[model samples]
Target: MKWDYLLFYRWLALNMVGFAILWVFHMNGMVEPVFLADSSYIVYVIAGLFLYGMVLCGFRVWKTSRELNWVKRGDKGKLKEFADKSRQSDRESVKEAFEIKLFARISFVKYISSSLVMLGLLGTVIGFIMVLTNIPANAVGDAAQVGKLVGALTNGMGVALYTTLVGAITNLWLNANYNMLRTGVVNLIAAILESADPQ
Candidate 1:
């Protein structure tokens, strides 16, 4: 019956600390410029998705923590309901039911984490397309168009590099959160099963 019920809270604290550090870098003009340079806006989309995933993780963590507390308090919570209903079932069945219930919503975080990387790759393709399209066929003989061509090339490259960077960093960030939530889910399942048996 001995379990670290504060696991989710500790993970949340770690997330907050990471965010604080990111904020510090952002305030010092280290992060905003990259986003501003990305005219394709794919980076923004990636950021939005990452935030959504974080919110999902946060909610799941909170709910899991509450359920753990309920189990600890011997209250008639979700785990109790599951235990009562699965009394006649085998241990494997009980474990399966607990996983299905706990992982139903939180699983979307994993999808979001994957999508972030894909979006970043999409941005890279778009940036390369922009670069190729901006090339003037006659720029070799046209001096006036060379400056514009260079500008366009730089813009496209910026978009490509920034989007890729944003996507990768956000994906890693979200996956970290997802992994923590997943670990919490596993712990919750163990606690529920142990409480059900107490042997």
Candidate 2:
């Protein structure tokens, strides 16, 4: 039986890397690109998705860790009590299992991660349009307008890329940890059940 501690360490390292990137961006004043309509939406959407994912992952980790600790106590009687409690109602059991498998499934992460990238692409397209619309037509103040438009475009692109990176990295780390924790949970439960059964 492979231990989950090592995998958890790897997950922590990856999470730290994601945080470091975000900190750097924040320190550089790139956290929220100066409020352009298109650019702002892109950042807001991606941040929302990643934040939701983080919360979901955190819940999975907390519940599984608590169960794993109990199982590791090697108290067969306690294990049987837990299993009985877990099956209190068919509907509740089904809901719990669904939550576990949902977190464990890598596809969930992929979908959100891809969505972040698409959001970035969409931002890029809008940013391009904004810049093109500002093209100078030999007007006296046209050059200044062009510069502002170009700056907005750059900011939009930057937010798009950074958000995508953060989302992907977070999803990857969470998925890896989910699998490791899930395996540990299943193993511990099985052992407890077997020991609790009367010979």
Candidate 3:
């Protein structure tokens, strides 16, 4: 029934800071922006966002673990209550307690983790289109033009492979981190809820 007044603002601030750090890395050429497609840093930025979301997810897991540990030890001095204690204690309060945990609040990372893979697939499609639309017609003459056409085709292939690789690898890492955090948090919540009825 209650909420952290600055929860959204806190998440937004952390995300903005992460994005700024990524931009600095890109501007300084510490992190390559284009990968293999001279088009732009669109794919790379999406991957960075995925990375940031993973970090946020990890933080949520750590914070929730601490809170749950405190609760298990019968210490709730500063822990935020998800259910109103003044109300009669019941299973409902346990549900409310789970709702207020950091893991529950930051579950959006699950979506972000999946979206990174989709963005990578999108890049692959774009690269294939570039290759198809730029294909040069064969000519009995002008062997030089044929060589240039081959070069263009090769570059297109680079875009497709690079984007797919970035996406797939990043997705694997994000998914692993996200799932681990989800499972740990879920188990901890169940344990904490079962330990005592919040009153």
lDDT of 3 by residue, 2-110 (tens): 3322333344454577568767978998556357463635467676787687678767756655665665666762233533442446657556555565455666877
Of the candidates shown, which would achieve the greatest lDDT relative to the real structure?
Answer: 1
lDDT of 1: 0.84
Which residue ranges in model 3 land beyond 4 Å of their true spot?
1-34, 37-40, 77-90, 93-104, 138-142, 197-199
The TM-score values for the models, in the order shown, are 0.90, 0.53, 0.68
Clashing pairs in 1: none
> Where does the lowest 10-residue lDDT sum fall in candidate 1?
1-10
> Which model scores highest in TM-score?
1
- Cα lDDT, model 3, residue 192: 57
Q: Candidate 3 at 48: error in angstroms?
A: 1.5
lDDT tens digits, residues 1-199, model 1? Answer: 4554586777778788889989999999989988888989998899988988888888888888778788777786777777777876776777786689788868898999999999999999999999999888987689999998998899899899999988898888888888888887787777777788757
Give, for candidate 3, the lowest lDDT window spanning 10 residues: 1-10
Error of 1 at 108 (Å): 0.5
RMSD of each: 2.4, 6.4, 7.5
